[model samples]
Target: MTFVHAGHGATMLFMLLLLLGAGAVGAAVLSRRVIGLRILDYPTGRSAHARPVPKGGGLAILVVFVTGVPLAQMIWHHTPTLADKTLLAATAWLGLFSWRDDMHPMPALWKLGAQVLAALLVAWGSLGILPHDGTAWGMLLGRSLWLVVLCNVLNFMDGLDGLAAGCTLLACVVTAILCLHAGAGVDTWGTALVMAVAIAGFLPFNFPNARLFMGDVGSQCCGLVLGALGLHMANLPPLAHGWALMPLMLSGLLADVGVTLLRRTMLRRPLLQAHREHIYQMAHRGGMQPATITVLAWAATLCGAGAACALAGGVIGLPAAAGGVLALQLAWAVVVIRRVRHTPGLRW
Candidate 1:
């Protein structure tokens, strides 16, 4: 028992150090060239910051995360897990493709193809599109679809500085605590620790008026990592608690993106066009500062994720917990939308 505890502790420490080091290196590279490149300039948009800032700093976070996973596998003397390796390969490719798009805007079809391929890679390799233990193909398909949708939702939510990172950090921390209580293995804990550290190191540079934006590299990379982790947690044996908790953990983001897309579609608006229609953006437009909006969103995420962890631990029933959280998030969204609509100077 003591040996197990020590090993877990060491793994967590190692992951944190690896992520921090990698993030620092990525940030340094971006800080030097990010402002000067202006390769694929960020044009003014509705939700855009007052001034154009260097984007693609997320490549730094991606660099640190993708490289650190394999390095940690070797250091721990454990064979690289199949899920981890598959996710890394897919995410690396996705990051590269996104970075390419960021450098030179690609056609919509090409971007969609890349996202599909990346999603398929994870579905085939990690989640195994065919269900096991009598689970139906429909169930497997639903899960895979959820993975892809969630990945895109997170990517869409990356409009504001530090928003995605802050939300992801909160989700990871909650997941880590649940996994720890459930006696999850070192790999699970290590993955969470690394993500926490990476986001923590990157947040300072990203918050408020960011010096650098995460861009495509960071957003897609993070989506992949979180998606992969969500699958891993859900696949854990016996209880498979992650499935029950996922909706709550992701309630805020899922609600925001889903509602925005649905609302846009209903109004015959182009879904793919960049816009400042998210609830967070609306909150900002409604006399709230960016930082205040971010904090409110983060606080809501923490509550939802905490409720998810508690439900997963069997302290609370899943349905009631998930439904309650969802209701709260939906209410928040409706209020934000109403405020945005009524506010005289608000732009959506």
Candidate 2:
């Protein structure tokens, strides 16, 4: 019992350190103003913010996360796993291109290509593209597709302040719980705990009227990390059916992006064109304040994630519990869309 308590304490302390370090680094990055310094200059046709803000705040997150994980391993006397190495390499590659994009506008095709390459690197390094029990071709294609879709979905959902960070925090907490309950190795739970802390530390500066944004650097890297973690969770021996949690965990963002794309396709809108069509944006354009809408979304995500974690932890059965939570999430999305649409002066 003492050993277990020690482990938990160590994990918590490590998380706190990472969070503080990441937040401080991000704040410092924002304070710089020099020629050739990368900054978000102004609102564009695709943006929601009206003023210029420092971008690449995710650089701080990546820096802290990258350094923190290895340090934790050293403190705990565990060797770095292959998955850890793969994550580091993938983050480095993605961060480079994302930083470039944040500094200067890059062609969409070029950025997309870099994302694809980075996803492939993760797949190759982590051996994470498919379920171990599945047939070779099917697993390869399915995993690759899942990685690509999730990576882009997270990137798209970064439209609002703190939304992606908040959502990822909820997901990581749930993942941590599930991992701990399943008796998975310390690395799994440790990684999730560390990520949750890092995001929490960064959230205050990002919520609503953000002082600095995660930009592409933060969002894409987060998406990659989550994708890797999800694959890792699904591969756990005790958690045979864990992949089922992905849909519920990501339901809100997936539904918004999926439905909006479908609606636009039906209306013959150009899919590549950017607009304030996301539900969060519409809610803000309506009478809802950004902070209020962000909180509401966070609340819904917490509930869904909690329910999923409960089910995964065996506190509830899978069939009824997962299904019910997913149903509620879909209903909530519908309600948000209807309210936003009905509000006067709301566009998209």
Candidate 3:
């Protein structure tokens, strides 16, 4: 739906600036603090980083992007709708519980349940993915499950430095640009940009022999927000909506994780077990530099997000944009899996 509450272009720009600056500073400061406190993550069998590194640095993002962005909206008197209010509460709860988990290990089921509850609140109480006219129970159920599953998968895919943060940044920025270009309302543009800038703050400390890891805190927080925002954009009122185009934003991630799981399952491997057989991980094991693999995955994300945008904006003549993106991701996954130049020395 077209929102017309007077001029918001300038306000939006100002908020973007605030989020970006705050996120970067918060991340840098929090990284130092975390390191000093010895809140570190040691390498494990299912791990990515080689050395111990500070974790829970995502609190900087929660403060600057998740909590701070909404606070700024309130200060600017944006008059948040119930949907916005729900988003605020949900983001906070997800970040809060995840932060708790970062400091002290929590039951896996508890985290999964929190994720499901967060998704349900947004999907049922706030941003209904289906319309109000008919029986949307099925759609809501599917959407709820989708949000929770995607949130976990995205969290799972956060296997390497800068991988999750960078993919999220790409998805948010591309979606925001597309929404703006399509003359979409401030809702999409504002939320997407806020997420992008916040992730930017955390990204620097991640990747390349990092200062810290986003840990489960950053991963889950970013995943939940990104999933919600994608749903928001996809469910935008009757007009100018593209529910089908939404998943393409994370096509690369979904494809890799999905394919990897299917392969393991076919081999009779326990599905619940943690392993490093993801295409990106395989690429890393195949002597590809972590940076190179991350860059390639990010490039795939860019292409997929761009295609999704094109589909959403009516630039594409067909409804096959999501398929196109998925095909690319699948092909990339295959290449990475097949091109292992050497067997992994580490117990994967």
Name the best candidate (by TM-score): 3
Whose lDDT is greatest here?
3
Q: Candidate 3, after superposition: displacement of residue 325 in Å?
A: 1.8
lDDT of 1 by residue, 110-221 (tens): 8777877887777666754456655555555565676668668778888777788888888877777777777776466566766666666677778876877777777777
Report every candidate's CA lDDT. Answer: 0.73, 0.73, 0.74
By lDDT rank, best first, the candidates go 3, 1, 2
RMSD (CA, angstroms), candidate 3: 3.9
lDDT of each residue in 1-348, candidate 2, tens digit only: 999999987886776565546644553453232112547647787677888876777776676567666766665566877677777788778877897888887988897788778777666656734446557656655665677777788888898888888898888888888888788765677677666766766676687678778888888888888887777787786764677666567777777788778888999998877777877777766667777877777776777676667666667777776677668767766767788779877556
In candidate 3 the C-alpha lDDT for residue 230 amounts to 73
Better of 2 and 3 by TM-score: 3
- Give the clashing pairs for model 3: none
The residue-by-residue lDDT of candidate 3 on 1-348, one tens digit each, is 134444475666676576657766776686667667778788897676778888887777766666566655654556677667666677789888988898898888898889888887777754435456455776667767877877787778887778888998888887777667656655566777777777777787887668878877778778877777777766654324466555777888888878888889889998766777888888887777888888887998888777876766677733578668867876876677566744555433
The whole-model C-alpha lDDT of candidate 2 against the native structure comes to: 0.73
For candidate 3, give the lDDT: 0.74
Q: Candidate 1 — what's its lDDT?
A: 0.73
